[model samples]
Target: LKFVCLANDGIDEHMVWLIGLKNIFARQLPNMPKEYIVRLVMDRSHKSVMVIRRNQVVGGITYRPYVSQKFGEIAFCAITADEQVKGYGTRLMNHLKQHARDVDGLTHFLTYADNNAVGYFIKQDLVAVWRINGSVAMFRQQWMLRTFALRRNSQAESKNVS
Candidate 1:
């Protein structure tokens, strides 16, 4: 599979990739709102990296970079259900890290992982960076050190939101 980085531009291929990514997220994250997914994925401030194989989009990640903060917030990451457990997720995350560092000048990544996704994030080597008073579990991976940390509130539940 090849990774296609895309933005919410007027380009035709990018528009197609965005639609495919939206479909993947809709199918993979059944609990999340489709409208919410569409809004974020199509937002100009957010960018996506789609995993394309055989000219079809199989998976992707949507992120927003905070250059001033030296980090990028991962809003949504999903591989098609059929494509799961095939190392695509790992490779996708690696690509995002490279793009964040080299292109976006980011040093860290921040993402909120729900219970169902906690394991996946951990396996990606992203641990809990910190715990807020709220119920969300924020996972962070330091690019330079390649370390992960996790602090979470198990009592609280949330949709797969950023």
Candidate 2:
């Protein structure tokens, strides 16, 4: 399971990979929404990671980085249907984490993952921090200090004392 991941900020030269991924998703995973293809290929703000194995796209991810929040949220991520459980997802995730930490100085990462992806996120140490719409699981990697939460707790304690 050797993976080659290429990072692209703007979406000019990676259209081929994007198109290939679209075809794979359409053919294999027909249930997957087509909106994700638009967001990944048409959007310029997303950071796209293309995972190539044997010169084809085995997986890909499109993530949005928020500098203010100091964490990047995974807009979308997936591996090929047949490629699942081969550790390719983990490799792609590590690539994104390295990009966030080394380039953006982000210590946290978040993603709205599906119920089936819960185990994968957990393996990456991203806790099921919350749930959205009582469906999608909001997973978070909290590697940085939570000063805001600490302060809020302290303030509440002081109020109780008074």
Candidate 3:
């Protein structure tokens, strides 16, 4: 799978993929509109990325400024049914995480994912911070310091051994 960071230029394609995602969600959660899905994908305030396999979009994610006033929220993340379990989701997530730190200059990252994605986020080391009854769930900010420290320590250990 290939991942690309996109701007408004990709909104049309994104809306198509988002409609697919919305259909999947609608199976479990009723009353989700295509306009809401389109807004989630086309909204300018959010930064977005797309994952493609063989030139066909398979997954995408978006991040927007959070209500916290300090951290950015991962507004949306969706992988096509066929693309699930193939590591595309993980790749898209890592890409988003890195973008938050490097491009957005955000020290922390946040998200509100459903039960299906909660485990994936947890596996990525995102801590669950809050849950809004049956409707929404929130996760806390991801810190890059620990990752840098681990990489630095590994490099030092390698140099010492060499």
Candidate 4:
């Protein structure tokens, strides 16, 4: 359940993790163009959060933070075939949201989910705005904002109690 942020320093330090993420994305998202995935995942402007279990990557999410716009565009998200339906996707996304909120100060998130992933995004509280070019728009809801604050406060409280 550990989430690791693969740094894009153009160095060899995080090469293995990046490769693992790329492989997972390739395996899970077959319809997506491989060239697109490779370019964005390796792009310096994008950042990824990988789910690491027992020193192996199980899932990951790639996103580009638009700091000036106060939003982050989620480029790709996936879990390995065997790992789906185990709630890893939810955790991975929550981790990514936290990273965006804390690190980049992003207030919203945007993603273009294909039909296959529409349900997943809906479950995560994202709504479809319009259906142009088959890209479903997912936005941050006001309730999610309040819920995130409450959850964070409770976690802090539990830590204080401990």
Best by TM-score: 1
Candidate 4: residue 59 Cα off by (Å): 0.8
Clashes of 1: 4
Query: What TM-score would candidate 2 get against the native?
Result: 0.66
Task: Put the candidates in TM-score order, highest first.
Answer: 1, 4, 2, 3
User: Which pairs clash inside model 4?
Assistant: none
**Candidate 4's residue-wise lDDT over 1-162, tens digit each?**
588776577666477788889899988877667878898899999999999988788989998888998877788889999989999998888888788888888876656555566667656654333222322322221111111121232221101000
lDDT of 2 by residue, 101-141 (tens): 77777766656445565556656544433223333322222
Superposition error at 95 for model 4 (Å): 0.4
Candidate 1, superposed: residue stretches over 4 Å from native: 135-162
lDDT of 2: 0.57
lDDT (CA) for every model shown?
Answer: 0.73, 0.57, 0.54, 0.70
* Clashes per candidate (backbone, < 3 Å): 4, 0, 0, 0
lDDT of 2 at 25: 51
lDDT of candidate 3 over 1-162, digit per residue (tens): 667765455567755654544454444323345556557656767656777666666767766754345467666667766658888877877787676666666655545445445556656655433332332312222211111110111221101000
lDDT top scorer: 1
Candidates 1 and 4 compared by lDDT, better number: 1
Deviation from native of the Cα of residue 85 in model 3, angstroms: 1.0
What shift in Å separates residue 52 of candidate 1 from its native position after superposition? Answer: 0.5
**Positional deviation of residue 68's Cα in model 3 after best superposition, in angstroms:** 11
Better of 1 and 3 by lDDT: 1
What's the TM-score of every candidate structure?
A: 0.80, 0.66, 0.64, 0.76
